[model samples]
Target: MPGLSLWLSPPPESSLYRALQDLITDLAGSVPAKDAPVFYPHITITSNIPIECDADEVVAFAASHWAADALATVTIMDFGPAFFKKLFLRIRKTPALTQLARECREKYVYGLATAEEGDPADQAAVWAQDEFDPHLSLLYTNSWPFSDEQKAEFGAKVQTVLETHSTEWTGGLLTLVPTYRSVDEWKPLASQLVGSE
Candidate 1:
């Protein structure tokens, strides 16, 4: 079972990527010395559940719905701790960003129902339509579990690093990835440039 997902990645040379690298380094250093997995800076558009579907068809559906004018001027607004002891840099969600995500879900992940199928309501309800909380993850604490006191102290340190290097980046690309169990196992299936109308 392959888990597919759509994501927006910043160019490696971009300031956003640099900031993310710095934050990750800072977080990694604060944690107990242990192996930490590194991942690209991205904002997830949709996380596909394991289902029987053609990968090419999925790519085509995403390509058709890709909005060239939906390039979002993303801002690193703040920092926060998430579930699973992960720290992330919160992004200011814009209308373009939300609409882009919704469009991807509606067109590709959740399609219109047929009369014979009676709306496929169960599947249609999988993805969220509420407010989008976009962020770039800095690191996960699985390797170095933290106590409540440690979490508070580490969270404050993360916040300090984020505040010191607030960043802005324009997102113009959407990528389809076949995700496996680990971050290192994710492989790109397709990518489409989305910008400039």
Candidate 2:
């Protein structure tokens, strides 16, 4: 991989990820093609750098970049949508997930050169740094056809649904895999966590 960044997300059991997937799948079924792919359950901790790909490279990367034992606890309570009009499951646990996200965020700052803007090589973009407001995205829509009333009602409905079913996530597993551009695709690589730190 030339341009890559470490990503952090709740493990499979995280209510946040599961809820987000369901929400997006249901809503995305009606949205445009551009909107459907945005539904992937992710809270990108850091990005914007061009690097190389190799098992050795990633192993060395994990050794220097990844954190070994960090506890990530997050709760899904409120329903919120991203600026893109996609709804998300919000984290309301006073940053139970922030600590883990920070480790990944720092990896970007320290690992390699951040990618140049306008370069077609970048896989993701930086919206803000370390302001890891973790939310699981659920919907995507254009701004042109939305009104205040629609947004408010959508949020309220989503919040009500989340309140009905949210699960606790703990004992996280850290897996360093290649960042892929598509579901049926992934670049192969391995990561090793630095032991000396």
Give RMSD to native, each candidate: 4.6, 7.3
Q: Write the residue-wise lDDT of candidate 2 on 1-197 in tens digits.
A: 22554444555455666665676566656444444443355444444333453435443543344444443333543433444335555544233345444444344443343445333222112323324466545564543344567557656656655676544343332334444344324333443223223
- Candidate 1 accuracy as TM-score: 0.67
lDDT of 1 by residue, 1-197 (tens): 14677777665556556766676777667667454566666777676533455555665665566554554444543333443227665666666666666766665555643456434434444444453567766775565345678667766766665566535555345677776456666677677654423
lDDT of each: 0.59, 0.45
Tell me, by TM-score, which candidate is best: 1
Residue 2, model 1: Cα distance from true site in angstroms: 7.0
TM-score of 2: 0.54
Score every model by TM-score.
0.67, 0.54
